[model samples]
Target: MKTFIASSPHVARVNRVDSIMLQVLLALVPGILAMIWFFGWGLLINILLAATFAVAAECTVILARGRSPLPAIADLSAVVTAVLFAISVPPILPWWMTLLGMLFAIVLVKQLYGGMGYNPFNPAMAAYVFLLVSYPVAMTNWLTPTMLAEHHLSFTESLRIILDGSLPQGLSWDAVTSATPLDEMRGKLDRDLTMDEIRQSPLWGAFGGRGWEWIAGWFLLGGLYLLWKRIITWHIPASLLSSLLVCATLFWAIEPQTHPFPAFHLFSGAAILGAFFIATDPVTACTTTRGQIIFGASIGALVYVIRTWGGYPDAIAFSVLLLNIAAPMIDHYTQPRVFGHGGKRG
Candidate 1:
């Protein structure tokens, strides 16, 4: 009998891409359910449409690349991208727009970069920025939360509005849609309204906006669950939130009348979501622990700056994309020293 030699230090790995992606999908459930509860069936519609489009796009790209499509599709990365894009967009976004964003995410952002692990930017966020720039008006047309709406749209009505751009009788786009909480705050501040006066609006909640705060809370819960399961490390999220809090607190202290509180920053828009899901992408984000902290802190600070002074109301997508470009450099400088090495080498 001949003995065959193999590579040294063989180890069994338990985690798979599909399994990790499945957990991420599970983690999104709390936030998704909360959105549907407050926003209505339009969210569900966008999710279904985006997911379908993403899978189709991924398959098309994989086949064109002369690779087996089923295995790539099975990893569920495209599905995750689709869901993230869906949740980020306005719930009432048109079906065609959703499809277009998914196609951009799956094909141009993901596949064109040589599939999942090769992309430098978060695909969903890149798609979001693309749509936002290309269709600013449509992207900003967020529907009023169900509680705030004068008339709650039924499933069929929401579907019609999304698919056909048809408003129900006696309803107009102005009547149904409103600025997001972040946008409302920016607009109010631009108009020189005091924070207290702005908070008096029904849209304002204990920390962030009424329905939006709770949705962010659910995302936080899901993030914590991921942390508990060891699906993600604490470096990125902790650093991101802490840096954001610090920036918000410093600005708020400087001008309490003009700036919202730190808690408001945490719970408003996509701060929490970006910290956990978008900023923590295994491929695009920094791999070293210290580098992750640096990367996340930069993103957090940029998010605050952009939200306060940049052109956009929510800055997560822009912040993450910017930091994605820096992650490799961050990792290079922050590489950990090898054990028992005599000294650090350049």
Candidate 2:
């Protein structure tokens, strides 16, 4: 009998790009359902539209580059990017804008940067910033939650509004759309309203915005599932939330009247989602454990600074993009020593 010698240490490789991407899609379900529940059918429409556009764009780019589209498309990275961008945008965003964002995300940001692992910035976030910069009005026109809206448009009406920018005779944009919770808080703070005064509005919930925090909670639950699956480590999410909480607590502690509570920072907007899903992208984020901690913390701190004083209402996209650029350097500096490496590299 011949004995075959394998490598010294062999481990089963159970994770693949497709499997990982599928898990991410599954994790997003709870959050997506929550969003649809609160915001209505527009959310569902945006997601489908964006996903379709993303796959189309990915195919086009791959064919243009002389590659078979099937393999690239099978990975589902494009769909993940589409879902993230769609969920991040205003539910009432026009169909054209959704298509435009998907094109930019897949073609310009992802493929043009040499595809997938080579791209320095998170494609979803890059596309979001692109749309926000180019079409501020559409990007900011978030619909009022179902409970708060004076009138809820039917599916057909929502479709018409997104497709052709048409509204019923009796309704105006202001009647259906309202500022997001983050936007509302920023506006109120700009007007010198105290935190107590701002919380008096029906928009305010126990921690974050009415109906919004629940969505964040669902995302949090999904993130925890990801962590438990070992698909993602806790370093990024843990450090990110900790840094944001520390910053928010410090500021709010110093001036309770001016700063919102730490829980508000954690539960509002995309803080939890970004920490778990966006910032934890394997290709664009730091790989080393220590580097990931630093990378996540920097994003968290930047989010706090920008939300407090930057021009934008939420800073997750901006902060993530900024950190994505630095991830390579972070990995370089924080690389783990090779197994039997000397104490010094002399």
How would you encode candidate 1's per-residue C-alpha lDDT over 1-346 as one tens digit per residue?
9999989658867678988899999999999999999988999999999999999999988898788999989999989999999999998899999988988888888888899799988999999999999999999998898889998888999999999999999888888999999999999999999999999999988999989999999999999988988889999999999999999999899999999988999998999999998898898999998999999999999999999999998999999999999999999999988886967687
List the pairs of residues colliding in candidate 1. none
lDDT on C-alpha atoms for all candidate structures: 0.93, 0.93
Q: Which TM-score value belongs to model 1?
A: 0.95
Cα RMSDs of all predictions? Answer: 2.4, 2.4
Candidate 2 TM-score to native: 0.95
Candidate 2 regions exceeding 4 Å error are 1-12, 339-346
Error of 2 at 256 (Å): 0.3
Q: Model 2 residue 132 lDDT?
A: 99
